[model samples]
Target: MTDLNARHAIVTGGGSGIGLAIARSLAGAGADVTITGRTLSRLEEAAAGDPRLHPLAMDVTDESSVADGIAGAVAARGPMAICVANAGVAEGRNLLKTDLTFWRHIMATNLDGAFLTIRESLRSMAALDYGRVIAVSSIAGVRGLKGAPAYSASKHGVIGLIRALSEDFLGKPVTFNAICPAYVDTDIVTRNVNAIRDRAGVTDEEALQMMVSQNRHKRLIDASEVGAAALWLCDPASGSVNGQTIEIAGGQAA
Candidate 1:
């Protein structure tokens, strides 16, 4: 629908969840998409015989892995026109209980991973006349989430990086933006439900309800909803919508 034919895109952490959804959306729009994750089998399975979707094994937390993986994608598909930095880990720990290791791990995956992915994609995108860079942040980035200081800080850093890069590339064809969503119904949410159940000593249903209530709409967001937002940003009409954070928090103002 967006007429992304002849375009090449890359989505990091695309084995499942939000990243996979975005990758599928881009591919459905006719872009040749490379989906990367640490698990080759999972990435391949996610590709699921789709000719438009290519799978690559990559570890975002490792600098060399990101650099090489992106390079490989470029070599295979050509210059990247759309880059989605969506690979992230979500975990909540009380500030007093968070150690340096925990903090660094969150930063490395969520913040550093985004930085490296964007930087690598920009290398080839700069030579092209048109490009779009989208980072998957969280509502927590806009406002600090309770008991997840490190995760919140990392997501906030992602938005900061996107905004700064948008400024740096003003007047250029490349546009940078961030997508912030709240309590999406994904595997992450499922895992978080279990964690909360254990930590809060609540039933799984109640724990899930906690997340659902966090969204302004009082329901879990469908992953496809976020995918649609990403697709809209990549549309030709969205060229002017640069350097903005599009919140999919069910009416929550970001």
Candidate 2:
């Protein structure tokens, strides 16, 4: 049996991309997973006929939605032993051209949403005293991504939250950590590629290369790589690995 046998987990944004991959990994490891997103159809699609993967429609940006959605998941699957706050928006805009609405939108989904998810999940996790809180930050969180001031700042804020929570929960059974990934081949990246192509008047290949070149490996990362990192963070022996940012940018020096 896997370490996650009979464990209950909640993965936000699990309708697609990295979130879905992580949910699959957790379920494969014997977890009873609740996959959440804003679209019920997408969430149901991700469930993919898997009995262990339950679909929950949730908008992380809405406090009431987060609260009720998590409550319902816990009521059905029991207390969430693992919470992966992976719901976020990835967009780039120069500081000069960015507006308050743009900045707040990113923060609402990336930073504030993560804070809400972690906060609500902890209400149940604290009772069990055993939990793993993983936030899907970006390499931008560590350093900074060019042309994306708002995104970088929001990601940095996520890492800050994780660090603070880790300190607050010192020596406790719960651990808080953030995974900083570079350009992974997800739908988000595809959208960014299109945006870049349109903005820069560059070819599709060139736009993709622009992102791929940022990684040390000069290749797009896989969602499973991030999922595996998350899995490692939840390992029984990883109790002492807290408050750290694990960068999966193909060995990028961050």
Candidate 3:
């Protein structure tokens, strides 16, 4: 573990799943981290697991909320030096069935939320001239998912944002990157399995298999896999890596 002592970090949607895993990894590396989510109770519960994890209720979709929430975290901890825009929503919907509200809902939480988090974190980190911005995008962001047009589009936007930000910070200490994981073993997969069972009238086992088959290796990725990847980007050795999308899809996302 690279000693992150005295470093300040932020992980959005850190209440559970991949976000929580990343938070824990950063804390274990010695960075003071604030985990934020829409629900205060969940955030508190997650924070209780580690002294380095502090709970902050912040709705990433809302601009003011993200600004104020990050500001509050800075006030309590310190200016964020590492930011993981890991909060996102994923759902499968046909283009025909994806209404405006559904499309906006997906974009707001995934793309817009990442934008806000990174924007605010930049204000703080740029002041110090050092930082790492990691966005938890998806393989869907890199390629198209069959049934989730809206979700895919939103994730694609996240990659675009990161790429653009990296260019904006060229020759600077800050680095912007995206992690595109195909199917991480997280609560999102469980929820997706239930949805698949309900919508397609498939057996629970069949529903589970459908997602497993999405990855070329025929296995779900562990949350820790993604966490370790995020932690590595924050390592000082990764300073030269910028404007890149790292894929963790077991194999090529096809």
lDDT of 2 by residue, 148-194 (tens): 99999999999999999999999889999999999999999899889
How well is each residue in 34-112 modelled by candidate 1, as lDDT tens digits? 9998899999899988999999999999999999999989998899999999999999999999999999999999999
Relative to the true structure, how large is the alpha-carbon lDDT of every model?
A: 0.94, 0.93, 0.93
* Stretches of model 2 off by over 4 angstroms after superposition: none
Candidate 2 has a TM-score of 0.98
Q: Per-residue lDDT for 120-178 in model 3, tens only?
A: 98888987767999999999999979899999999999999999989988999999999
Please tell me which predicted candidate would have the highest lDDT against the true structure: 1
Off by over 4 Å in 3: none
- The candidate with the higher lDDT, 1 or 3, is 1
What's the true lDDT of residue 229 in model 1? 96
Candidate No. with top TM-score: 1
Q: How accurate is candidate 3 locally (lDDT)?
A: 0.93
Better of 1 and 3 by TM-score: 1
- True-structure lDDT of candidate 2: 0.93
